[model samples]
Target: MEKDAFAQQLPVEKYTRNIENKSIFYVIRKEGDLTKPNFIVSYAWGNYRNDLVMTMFGRLMLLMVGLIVISWLPCLGIARYFTRPLVQMERHVGRMAERDWHEPISTSRKDEIGRLAKAIESMRQRLVRQDRAQQFFLQHTSHELKTPVMVIRSYAQSIQDGVYPKGTLNESVGVIMKEGERLRYRRPEIKWEMDLAPHTTLIGDQEQWKIALENMLDNQLRYAKSCIRIVVKSQSLDNENAVKGQTSLSKFCISNDGPLLDQAIADSLFEPFRSGGDGQFGLGLAIVKQIMDHHGMTVRAANQRDGVSFYIEPGKQTDKTSVPKVS
Candidate 1:
């Protein structure tokens, strides 16, 4: 059997021989007869590629490298797509921290990030408005304070120099007192005749209107002898001029029985820095005018029999006149 295995010319295979310096290869028989002897064959084919790597192994390594390179682009694109919103949010937050409100944000998206952006944008707008309001307040306040401070200092120096005004010092002292009053909030003794509607609600910043009203009352208080009257009424529009459905216009009027305003002073009463023979600057009325304008209202000063009446028409219709909540 061993001689026949060696002598056979065709390819043949059998159980491996227990010997060194021999190799093995598998091959199929050429005759296609399964029943014949030595139908399978084995031989030692010298290594082709190298001792370090086989041909099959090298092919597999090349295929793996190609796959990794091909997949790199798609992986990078997917990563950027997922992080795009996060990057936008970071930029928006940075702008907010810097107090930049000029750039508007996108609110059209219907997602969680969209909602977050919308909330932040809303906060930015409110902060911008408040900042602008504070700046205006400071500018007006400083301007108003400057004249009084200068006047007080000048008068004090004159008194020290033995130079006095011809009339009593009461008027000079009253100048200082009035300027001081402007800075301090005081509720003085006077009769308040309020004929306000029950609801009396208008679309406005209540605090701002309150400050404006206080300024008006304070100005009147400085001159008023006994009474100050406030009237809030809904004036019905003439049927012919009325809009299709709307009926009445809300109006607020304040009158004081101190003294009738002078015609010249009344003309420039709402202008800043103009005075009415008193030590007070005209900033109070100017501020009132600004507040009315902010609320889209119109204010007019008219001479009354005893004093002056400030008529304010806040342009809107009220739902109903209920007692205003005091809180």
Candidate 2:
């Protein structure tokens, strides 16, 4: 790969962006390979002389000089309005390379730069959505398996207490044992909720949705103290969802009594490979972000007067109902 990349960087005899308005293949052969003969030749597949690059060298150089002039101190100040955003974007990528996404690329432009800014903002939001979804998935997955596990724990103790005879209990009791084993290795727990409004069934990978929801519930159950609340409400104009132009949504929140994490720490919660808080791979939230990105949703964290809360906000639906569950 490095060799291929370096080969592309080799000084061009002549380089010109003003090629034929069509794409053509550029073929190169190994040095001194005499499959046919030893000759220096080049060709093009589009109209216009293939030698245009060679002749246009002067114009290209002038363009370069013109750019240099345009970037001079006085001109630079004026150009900063356009170039600043791109420079920020480049810096943003560098931060992203270091596994940072909390800082967004900033821009104040109404042209092409604005479009790029919008794109980056959209990407940031999508990423946030994915992270939240992932956290929920892993948490629920761990939670779902707990019930059968507890059953086994209970019955095993019962058998030791001689609560039921061995002959009469072997069949159904054996089933419980099998289920315990199945759940023992599973991560997270399973939780369910139902509401009458009937959040219109969304067309999606049903399996993925179930896993994600379960993971969220698991996270809540694990972190929550006594009570956790979840509310699936219509995407309403009264909420921030309206600002983002969201129509229908499934908002899942898990409020806990635990001390709210500072923004600096909480911001890092969804990052992959980041284990910021106790009992956390940090991949769960990352996965949630990915799933939410695919589904066009948003997630946010806030500290309420009573406790800390995290919300999953979904968008995209004209009219729909919601099914919410609370624990």
Candidate 3:
């Protein structure tokens, strides 16, 4: 192109030109005097653009590869950190399903996973305890049942052989009847003297309460001489026995004119299969204790001057009161 045509078309600095259907990038500058002459420097724009695009694309790919390499280890570590506990929990649950409760579950983490592990461990411990208790109960029940069965069989055999085991036919038959009563789980007849307050409010499962009461009365009647006194009254909670946010509670007291219990026997009286030196099934007091504990109530037995007394009272006060009616 002519110099005047370049001056007319191109400005100072960089400019684009098309020649022979090819893009060209050029720059112009004055050689000597600012207004006298200018020189042009030019290069192919399409080739430069292609090279620049390829350089950027190569750098971008290299950066992405570096980022992936750097992130792989941490991502794997994070996945294992979360999945390790889940795998352990899955094994523990499988063991539990197989009824293998000997192995204890444990986790030291303080997150939600740790809390779940603690709860599962608690459940496993409870299952272990219950299994042991059931086995013990079955063993004791078989032994207890065996004794009464053997006595009845021996006495009947003696009667069939025209032999009097207790020295006379009447006495032998009475022995058989008493043994039958033992098998029948009969409680001895006693006069019930109740002094329950009017409108006394005791809240719990009705059927469970009935079972607990029956078991308690059976235990008391076995040792009682003639009278069993049941008293239901309301009493204010003392500081020691006071539950939070409670002012009063209802008390149930049952007393029997029975022989005093030994301190050791009295201490563990409510434990399962604890016999009181008598040939008796000792599950009654234990049943009462279970019922009381389920209802958040407390039961205690103490030796009185001439008898034994059992007191059952709520551990927490119900808002409903058991105030005696003013007559």
- The candidate scoring highest on lDDT is 3
Q: Which regions of candidate 2 fall more than 4 Å away from where they truly are?
A: 1-199, 235-250, 315-327
Rank the candidate models, highest lDDT first: 3, 1, 2
lDDT of each: 0.68, 0.59, 0.77
lDDT of 2 by residue, 164-241 (tens): 534557864885768766743232333433332333333245565666666566556556555566666554334333
TM-score-wise, the better of 2 and 3 is 3
lDDT of the structure predicted as candidate 1? 0.68
Model 3 lDDT per residue over 221-255, tens place: 77888888998886544445345543333788999
Pairing residues by index, what is the TM-score of model 2?
0.37
Model 2 residue 35 CA deviation (Å) reads 97
Writing each residue's lDDT as its tens digit, candidate 1 over 219-285 gives 8777777888988786444446334543343777888887777888788788766656463554688
TM-score of each: 0.41, 0.37, 0.53
Better model by lDDT, 1 or 3? Answer: 3
Best by TM-score: 3
Question: How much does candidate 3 score in TM-score?
Answer: 0.53
Put the candidates in TM-score order, highest first. 3, 1, 2
